[model samples]
Target: MQKLTIQWQRLLNDKNQTCPRCSETGETVNTGVLKLKNALAELGIEVELIQKAIDFSVFENNPLQSNSILINGKLLEDWIGGETGKSKCCDVCGDSECRTISFGENTFESIPENLIIKAGLLAAAELIEN
Candidate 1:
């Protein structure tokens, strides 16, 4: 059986609250990915979405992308980024020299459901992209 993989590495920025943009993006990805999972199950295709909100410091040594969506271990920019792609200030990780993780691809706040759905379909592995 073949399994599709969807990974969203949300790098935490501020201590008080997760970045609004990232928060929304994460929620969209989670919900969309879950739906994709159930849909693919009928085809006997497994889906794995790594649900971990990692810190910026970890991204420094992260094998995968920090603020990006990866499908089947491939870094493909199909989802949304933060307001600014630059690192933001964080009091909690101040001494740690860690800042908010940004990808700089979006000027908006939310990741569209359609985008994640597209990503999910692409991650199916068996889908033929023409």
Candidate 2:
């Protein structure tokens, strides 16, 4: 079976806690992965999810890197024709602005599961085409 990889990264404080946005996105990602697995199984495609944690030091320099998702090695926003932006996050982020995704008129701090599933489906389509 072929494989589709979805990678999500977020900032982790010393206590291994992340901002609310990242935490919610993590839950969405997990749900998305499960959905994708079921949806793609018949197509001989395997769904793989990789969760990465960015240290506080790294987040201090580039907070925007946190709460990022990549499908098939490409940004989720790229796959979905969304725009990437940033906004001030919660205390776990410590005054840093975290990543946001903009689609049309709406902008989301915590990425929604629909977007994740959409990206995963698009990626799975590409995998099959190739």
Candidate 3:
């Protein structure tokens, strides 16, 4: 089997508060990855998987929902099944109240579990399919 690489963009940068929602999203992706790893392991599938995370702020020019799923560098937007809302305050910031974190339109606060799972599975299968 080949190695699969999963990459995700995070909305919460180093400057902002630790967004639980974003963390939850990361956990969801990791869980799916774990599932794939274990299942493949049982089959003696020699597959190597690596998850990559990037800050959304890097794409300063484009802010048109880059938080998408990718299968071998190809954006699988359909698999990124998360509903994106307009710009909003940082609900996960501060100790007791929500704070305003200025992130451009491209930032993704959270990704739905379904998208993550689908992406994970796709990447997993891509290892064997490719």
Candidate 4:
């Protein structure tokens, strides 16, 4: 299998945390993506909403985006496989890990950077013409 490539910049400036789940937070974020996505799909939805209390805390240390990729999304499953290996346990809740989310045109798989730039230019041209 191809190794997953995840490149991301931290959302919050501060990485320090006194949260209770600091120890396993990393695991939670990683596994949560897969589980969350699957859950949403089962419900016949394309998007998954993760409230602060239900999802990861907005604690000073928490990231706006935990990983480079959002789990349960269209493109990532090819790399992450099904909900068995990487997306099973909830590193955060320690519940069964029920929630799952998907990708939109804004997502990397849908609108890659190159396409975004091209589309942006086209929109800009249309605006200028108007």
Q: Candidate 4, after superposition: displacement of residue 69 in Å?
A: 15
CA lDDT, candidate 3, residue 43: 53
Models ranked on TM-score: 2, 1, 3, 4
Each prediction's TM-score against the native? 0.62, 0.97, 0.54, 0.22
lDDT of 1: 0.58
Worst 10 residues of 4 by lDDT: 1-10
| Model number with the top TM-score | 2
lDDT per residue (tens digit) for residues 13-76 in model 2: 8897988999999999999999999999999999999999999999999887899999989999
Model 4 lDDT, residue 116, Cα: 21
TM match of model 1 to true structure: 0.62
Top lDDT prediction, candidate number = 2
Give the alpha-carbon lDDT of every model: 0.58, 0.93, 0.49, 0.30
TM-score of 2: 0.97
Error of 1 at 74 (Å): 1.4
lDDT of 3 at 74: 50
Q: What's the true lDDT of residue 12 in model 4? A: 23
- Taking all chains together, the TM-score of candidate 3 against the true structure is 0.54
Please report how far candidate 4 places residue 110 from its true position, in Å.
9.4
Pairwise lDDT winner, candidates 1 and 3? 1
Candidate 1, number of clashes: 0
